[model samples]
Target: MEATTTSQPKTISPPISPTFRISGGRRFSNDTSVAYILPSDQDEVKRLKLNHDLWKELMNGLFKSDMHEQLTKGIRVLDVGCGPGWWTLDMAALYPNSQFIGIDMADVFVAQDLPSNVTFEQMNAGTGLEFDDASFDFVFQRFLVMGLSVEQYSSSVTEMKRILKPGGAIEILELINDYSNASPAFARIGSWIHQAMSARGLDSFIADKVSSVLETAGFKNITDVNYDVPIGPWGDESGEMFLSIQKLALPAVKVMVTELTDTTVEEYDKTEEQAYKEALSHQVSTRFRLIYATK
Candidate 1:
């Protein structure tokens, strides 16, 4: 693939001050260390796949940028916090002329014998990104609100900006709200999950505020596109996909949620079971936001 001949001009970015207060800095026992509410295991891979499928259905495309057109024109791309490498691999297959790289805390499900243009690296999102400045034409991140602290979230975007080519496009897709129009069981699960994340110093609602943060990090011409996903079997394919992801994640996260919310394991399990049933009746929904900007 050919690289762009000239770097785009850099713009002046605002200060990187955090607007939200995410809680205490607690760590989780997982491969990523700080991002283990659902832990990096086989179930985690399935969860990533399910999430990818849901996004594919909702966005009707992998990205909202002109990256696909640029891919054929030889634009380099980076997928940050690229769990399981699903997005990286799929994009690589479709755009052979574009070089694609996926980076995460671990290669939990990264495939061997990847396409010639594709690469995978193990790295933490909070620490410095291990790449030179002005390296990529496009940088994409998704679903990191659950893992990164408020400070880290801002810094990580700064890191992303550092690696991006002067006019590179950065796209972030995040789920800001996990509950709306819920039954009692669904509300319990949603409340506990929200409270648990906050107590552990994570922000489950950062999706709505990412555009502003990107602006603070010096991005320009930012655009915010929103999507609402219904949660429940009756909500059709997207809902079923969400339910499958929940089935894998909920069991692993039960201990964390119950301990923080002061609920018995048995009671939590029963509530989750009821919530699953209620989901079939179309009782829950979530909000996702996609913020894209130029560095």
Candidate 2:
């Protein structure tokens, strides 16, 4: 892998600032500029690892964008909202020739010994990216449904387009926030999640509108794909894995959602229990959307 270059002329970023606030025994990024609701503690780290593992297994790779050849040949890459730096670190290892920069609002980066080609920086993508124009060959963001609101997401795409070199590709993967053929229990949980998101000016169903954002940002050759993965044993190994992910994910969001909405901890726990059972009986699955385009 190439050594990480710190003073590249093409790169210009602001000083990093990471701030936090504690709530309900879980630590979270307290920046009021963002509607991010997830905890940033080690328990959340375990959940993220599980989620990343499941995503890799289901997709059969680190990403869905058509960048394998470009990555192998080496290019400058940026990972937005790179929680724990798992994907950035993994991709750097896989494509040793490529340079990777991962950015986030929190300093919760995972690896102590980062690969030479990879560097983790602290900056909130929602506020604005500080990188120079046309600084990167590719930009990738994933699973930020709970972190970015609709307006913030749109502006972030514009910033991504500005930083991407001509003809550079940008890819985003997001959950649709609603389940397919949901049972009552799952539906209830979805309602609470929707209420919580709306209370913060975020759209839980924002994945459906990403194409418009890319188009409005003047990106071309846009391609969007959707995957519905099962949530329980009935759907096989993937389902079992997703079920485990959900078990942790719901609790991760509980501290924030309950605070935002009328939901009580007791009611949330009960619904989650029922939702797990419904997952088995109803064969529920969550939908994910992957959108890619060129600047």
TM-score for each of the candidates: 0.86, 0.92
Worst 10 residues of 2 by lDDT: 5-14
Candidate 1 local lDDT, residue 30: 42
Q: Model 1, poorest ten-residue lDDT window?
A: 3-12
Clashing residue pairs found in predicted model 2 = none
The reply for model 1, stretches above 4 Å from the true place, is 1-36
- Stretches > 4 Å off in candidate 2: 1-18
lDDT of candidates 1 onward, in order: 0.75, 0.85
* Residue range 1-295, candidate 1, lDDT tens digits: 2222211222122222232111222223443335535455555666777788678767776888766668877878999989777788778777889999888764463655667998878788876789999999999999887768777888889999999998899999987747778788878887888888887777888887898899888899999998877776767888878888778667757767876778788998899898888888755887789999998
